[model samples]
Target: MKKFFTSLQTKLVISFLLLILVITGGTFLITNTQSKKALLDSTRDDMLQTVALVSTQFTAADLQTLSGFKAGDDGSPAYLSMIRRLRDMRSLSPNMVNFYIMSIAGNNISFVVDDAVSGPALVGDVYTDPDPRLFDAVAAPSVSDNFYTDAWGTFISAYAPLKDANGNTAFVVGGDMDASQVITRQNFIGTTIYYIMAGAILFAGFMIAIFSVTIIKDIKKLDKTADEISKGNTKVSVDVHRSDEIGDLADSFGRMVASLKIMMDMDEQPGDK
Candidate 1:
């Protein structure tokens, strides 16, 4: 077993195989990481664009009027108008999971216009416990990057503040996209990368097998020639002709065989002339 491993053919094959594995593994890791980042960035950009489009549909006055009304007071003009807008926005894109308007006051949040028809909050119902990230979104000059989870599930949210005539934020418009979609996309990319890497490894293995066979064939020929030379046959010749290290070894062996043949012929002569 030790001899087998020490053979030139085995060493050559193993060296190439290890090299291929290292290269393929490193490439796979780099490609997988970059792909995940690109996909996530693309998803976030799409979310931002969707939020921008939705926010454009409402004016500051519309948001101000809606903020003055309570959640359950759907009969009010502002309330009804905002609900209609939310429904329209929801229908505009299938990816838009939730759309609503919110009012933020010093870490406290109150729902002004929630799309939930059956069990929506009342206008005065305030949520004192708010994620700090949510405050960052409310304070952001434009759309903010934030993620949150609630009864609906995990979501990547984009917030756009609605400003009154005096340039103060009257209310905030928010759009949510299910975080599961991003996760699913990432998983798909990972699977694809795995498949590609598997194919590449198999191809490298096949090529290496062919290369090892050629090298081993030449080495066996040299070995057989040497064995015949050991049995008193000095006329054996190694036919391998190349410029590589193996070729150089074959050339040296051929020269030694020739020298031995000359010495034998001289010894067979009658005597030293």
Candidate 2:
């Protein structure tokens, strides 16, 4: 086991594998973080802008009517108008889930009107689970810093204040959109990193195997030539063909063989005399 680990082939392969892993892992982490931030920032900005524009189309009277929060209020012109606008706004993009109005009463936030017809929450219902940002949004436009989940699955939301006759914030216009695409993109990136790491390991292993084998074969040739020359046979050639360090060593070995043959021949001529 110790010899196996100490072998040149094993050392070369292990060292290269570690280097590749570090490089690939670092690159993947950076790409993942940057991609998420870019996607989130771009999406959040768009959502905030869209909701902010929608707020301008309505007046204080339009907002005040939705406050009645009764079954009768649901039939009012302002309520119907809000629902129609919510659906129309949502229709602008397939990824849009819903558009709604949430009333801010002090620090408490609740639903007043929603484009969604069913079950997550309905008109006049206070959010049992709310993102704290909703309270801050009462003052101005704001967006979720990241994806959040509730009964409606995952979404990135934005809110903009709707002003009253006195120019005070009367309500908040909110938007919800699908987050699956971004999540899927991140997942795809993660999978791609695994594939890259695997490919790097395999490629490095193959190259290291070839490199170590070539070096060892050249060194063995020199060793064999040395042994034969020590037994008075200097005719054998060193047959290594490389342009690297191994080739230089082979050239040196070949010169030593030629010098040995000359010395042996000179000695033989003196004996012949």
149-206 in candidate 2: lDDT tens per residue?
Answer: 8777788888889888887887888888778976776677667766876787788778
lDDT of 2 at 199: 86
Model 2, position 9, has a per-residue lDDT of 64
Top candidate on TM-score is 2
Evaluate candidate 1 by giving its C-alpha RMSD to the native, one decimal. Answer: 3.4
Model 2 segments more than 4 A misplaced: 75-78, 192-209, 227-235, 261-273
Task: State residue 211's C-alpha deviation in candidate 1, in Å.
Answer: 1.8
lDDT of each: 0.75, 0.78
Candidate 1 residues 187-229, lDDT tens each? 8998899899999999999999897887788878888888887
Candidate number with greatest lDDT: 2
Q: What shift in Å separates residue 61 of candidate 1 from its native position after superposition?
A: 3.3
lDDT of 1 at 6: 94
Clashing pairs in 2: none
